[model samples]
Target: MTSQDERRAFWEERLAADWTETGVGYRALGRSFNEWMYRVRREVFLDRVGALDVDWTRARVLDVGSGTGFYVRAWQQLGAASITGSDLTEAAVARLRDHFPALRFERLDVAEPGDTFAGADFDAVSCMDVLFHITDDDRYTAAVESVARLVRPGGYFVFSENFLHRPAQRGVNQVNRPIGWITARLDRAGFDVVHRSPFLVLMNAQVDAGTLWRKAWGGVLRAATLTEPTGWLAGAALYPLERRLVRSRTESPTTEIMICRRR
Candidate 1:
């Protein structure tokens, strides 16, 4: 098992460099890795909630740990009035602004004091794929509290992390599960749970099974040469298999979306 300091430095170093460029075999292959994964995660997430209308027009969104500004760009494309992306990595914020010149991006670590973009400046907030990086238990609490402070009442805040069936399955998810226990924290911070999508959360017991399985699946299909009908048939068959695999906590932790509104 990795020590807390080691794990913390893993992310600290990973973020110190630009990583949004990692190649992915997602739907938008020609686009950047972060962009493609953003679409995949967002679409799959919203599909669970049966929502197609995101209502992002004229909305101000603050994206925490906004590596590559994936979702920020997604919302901006949907006509959001403004999007502010904050990250610990200066390179990340720089690249995001450089690529999407129209949007606003800044460098800030909510965990650190005196960091800009600290509070009450957004109508929406999204913290994705970074909750596990917070090794300090209290830091997680602080992060959520700061997010709540930054959003207006009735505004939306979305954050996600994986969970195991039991604490014993901890190694399977690699990242931690304060996210699961924080349901009370969300309510305590005056947020109402509008929706929770428990998908990509089935693969436990296997080492990072959710993330690995997803990437392997993508890589396998990346070289596909099938026709539309063939691909559709394959998808129909594949989806059920995936469902069977993920239906049990013994299997996966691909992803999950929890949506809450500041009350």
Candidate 2:
């Protein structure tokens, strides 16, 4: 099947299974480490983007690949001028509309750039956790370039990539590159890198993507790893620890964040 068909199937499965049109709830609903991990991730990411101010009220914000409009509610809470959320999934958009009557939703395959963001649009734009699934390098480059073209000159393109730091991890989310390489890609794409960090541990794949029991055990391990100097020691003792060393100063940084402006 094609990529479009795959994403469509992913959303259809979610809608047939977990799409909720109620109050603000993330992709995951249960109050567990998984939910907390997502919340903390958003909190950290939002803070890193410096997008928490109330001045955002009514500011035109575009959320690309906005599954269930998770950040849509946030942009609204921060006083976004308006939020235009686009995704490849009809069921996801339908769910978002049922929840937020005022928000705008559009349908498009995220793998293609021009399918959405027609012109130099909006004050700022963002796409969280959506780039990595795009395995085609040429298409990925095109999509990033398209995002750049959509933003007004001088407008910030607030986004992040799970850089492919490890060559073997290439087929997964693009979460394995260094800041310099990533900055180069942004430069080529016409983005000006203003600020960036080495890495930040976003989530544990084995936990968030794991089963309930695995997550429970993983949470316990995570809790142990957060207890000050001991976690640092535990990380060192552990083998192939990039999963926990995200952006850790004591450990080699794993995940990173970059803030860039249109050049």
The candidate that wins on TM-score is: 2
TM-score of each: 0.68, 0.70
Give the clash total for candidate 2: 21
Candidate 1 total steric clashes: 9
The 10-residue segment of model 2 with minimum total lDDT is 22-31
Q: In model 1, which regions exceed 4 Å deviation? A: 1-18, 21-39, 45-54, 113-115, 168-174, 178-180, 199-252
Global lDDT of model 2: 0.58
lDDT of 2 by residue, 143-217 (tens): 677778777777777765544433324433232333455566678988887755533352343311225755674
- TM-score of decoy 1: 0.68
- Each model's lDDT comes to 0.58, 0.58
Candidate 1 lDDT over residue span 1-263, tens digit each: 55544754554566455355232112222233223234346554445323533566767888887776666755665666777787766657677788778767776656552646645567788887666556555666777787888888778887766644434234421455644566766777788887655444322122234567757655544433134444444444445455544334332444556778888
Q: What is the lDDT of residue 256 in candidate 2?
A: 47
